[model samples]
Target: MRQLFGNRAFVLLMVSDFMQNIGIWIRNMALLFFIMEKSNHDPVAVSLLTVIEYVPIFVISMIGGVLADRWRPKRTMIWGDVLSFLSILLILFVVLAGYWQAVFAVTLVSAVVSQFSQPSSMKIIKRCLPDEHVPAATALSQTLMSLFIILGPMVGTTIYQTFGLLASLISLLVLFAASAIVLTFLPSSVDQAPDTTESAGSLLKDMKAGFSYIASSRLLKVLLVVYVVLALGSGLVQPLDIFVITERLQLDMSSVQWFTALEGLGMLIGGLIAAVIAGKVKGTYLLFAGLSFLGLSTFVEVLSQWPMLTGTMRFLTGVLMAMAQTVLMAVMMQQVDEKFIGRLGGVMMPVFTGMMLIGSGFTGWYMSATSIVVVYFTAGALFLLSSFISMKLPISREPVQEEAEAPVSVNATVKV
Candidate 1:
């Protein structure tokens, strides 16, 4: 961990990102609760609010990625943070004024505005880290982000329960402001201006090229397909777990909250393990092993009815999921070139987001009509199938040639 933090710029970026994630998670939890309260605890209305928050990402994330590639990443991220902060302030005002409908609209707009930042952040991380350190850095980032998941809900619930909805919104705004401040420290060199030569192409042509690149690469396509499958399978777990705990096991909301926290804790531990073992292990092997564990854990979860066993299985599943995700991301980052990273990210963002959206909707509908146990069994089966599909991909065991390059000082490296 000390070696990983030796790069001051990466450390600063991680700190800012940690704060931003915490704020995002807190706002999300509070928003769900607020919507429930305002609608007289209507489950359908709360679900609608959740849908509104994520729908924009599916609609606009591709454009966000394109803009990230065309503009400077640092500027893009700073502006995104600024817009998000302003949106939060507006939401805060509306909440304070008791205009619940207006708050919902503003929240949806905030979600749209925030989508612009993800590609730029992803590109920056790809550019800044050396090939050898990329896996470890990815693991560190995932660990920090997961750690926030444990705290954010607890803090948000406490604040909402104690103060009010307005306070929760204000807290998010403060965190966004802090994120913007930290982003400002990044050097101008990190931002890559759009290429004049590429400016002549039509939008459709450019988008096609991006898709073509991903399709032509065997490893990239396989990774993407496996991700989609995993996303679809994992989606069933959320609603199924909720039903099992609330309807079958008779656990209250507080217990559910704590169970979620335990899942986050497991992810944190898994990420830390990845970071510690990063350079010593092959990313492909780690990913494969993790996915296998995830499949087995899901099966265990589906069979277990006791609260203790269910919680343990959920925690183990989270750990394996985190390990798989971190390793896959690190491997993909190493495979792609720096110049096209943004465009590649743009192509991936929409696909991944769309898959999750589809998965959520499908799983929600399926669980509504069928038994929770059936849903879990289906999810576990899909996971096992995805693991088998993943094994068919040809992931290279050798490190990329760039991993042998001499380390450059942070001062000398371009920011973008």
Candidate 2:
């Protein structure tokens, strides 16, 4: 871990990711609070906001992928951060101006732009890092992200309570600016571009090509399905957390914030575990174990409605989810060609995002019409189904190669 961070580019990337993640969490908490508190809206409204925020990623992720492949990843990331910063500024302006509806609209636009930025940033990391360190590197990145997740909500809630939403927006904007500055110093490399001669074909053909790539690859197909199910199942728990704390447990808002923080703490631990064990274990086995834990944790929540038990279950769920996600991402990075990483991410984003949207909406509706316990049971069942499906899929392992005679020069740029 120390050696990994010794690479300046990796350190820079980690710092930038950390800043942006902090901003993301703050913005997310603010959006949730704004909808639930200020707007006096229900879960459906929160779901709608989430849908609008994520729908663009589903729609534009492919375009973002193509662009990431065609352009220099670092430059793309810089521009993306710039746009995100601007968007935050716009949100801050609206909040300051007291136009709450306009703030929502601006927030949606900002989310769309951020979605476009994500693929490029991911591509840059893939390009800059060598194959061996990728998993640890990715784990470290996620660890930093989880740390921000731990801090952002607590800090945002405090700021919101003391200084109101406008102050929180301003803090997010400052963080975004810092992220942009950190990203600007990284190395740059363009992703592989599609052949111009093939560009004249039908749009459907291009779409089919992307789908065909996944279809032909057995491992990707299974992984994609697993993630889709995971997204759907996990989505149920997020919105329901608030409901569980307020309605079922009769806890105040501060306890809800603590629950979020505890979940982040669990995720940090999971990421650390992945980092330590990544080189030692087969990615597939780790993934399966993680998924199993996730399903079991969800079931625990369903059976044990006690606040302490439920919170502990949520913490365990975070750990399992982080392990699965970190390992999956690292495995995918290793197995998939660099040129297609962005597109693969693009294809997966919508399926995952859509699942989350549906899950959040379903949980909200279920909570309103039925009981929180019922929602937990349904979520657990879905997770179990996903785990079962994952077990049947063949594991795709990276091909082993002879060790390089010498360390690859850190400054050398490699074309994908």
lDDT of 2 by residue, 151-205 (tens): 7667767777788777878888788888878877775443343444433333344
Give per-model TM-scores.
0.87, 0.81
| Residue-wise C-alpha lDDT for candidate 1, range 1-416, written one tens digit per residue | 67668876687688788888878877888888888878999988887887787777667766565556556788888988899899888887787787887877888888887777877777777666677888888898888878877887777788888987777787888899999999999865566665544434444554555565666667777878887888777676765666667766677855787678878989999999888888797666677777777777766765666889878877886787788878877876777755446567666666766776667678877877887777777777777777877776676643323222323211111122
Worst 10 residues of 1 by lDDT: 406-415
Off by over 4 Å in 2: 29-49, 92-100, 160-170, 189-206, 236-256, 305-308, 363-375, 396-416
Q: Write down the TM-score for model 1.
A: 0.87
User: Model 2: which ten-residue window has the lowest total lDDT?
Assistant: 406-415
Error in Å for residue 173 of model 2: 4.1
As for model 2, its CA RMSD to the true structure in angstroms is 6.3
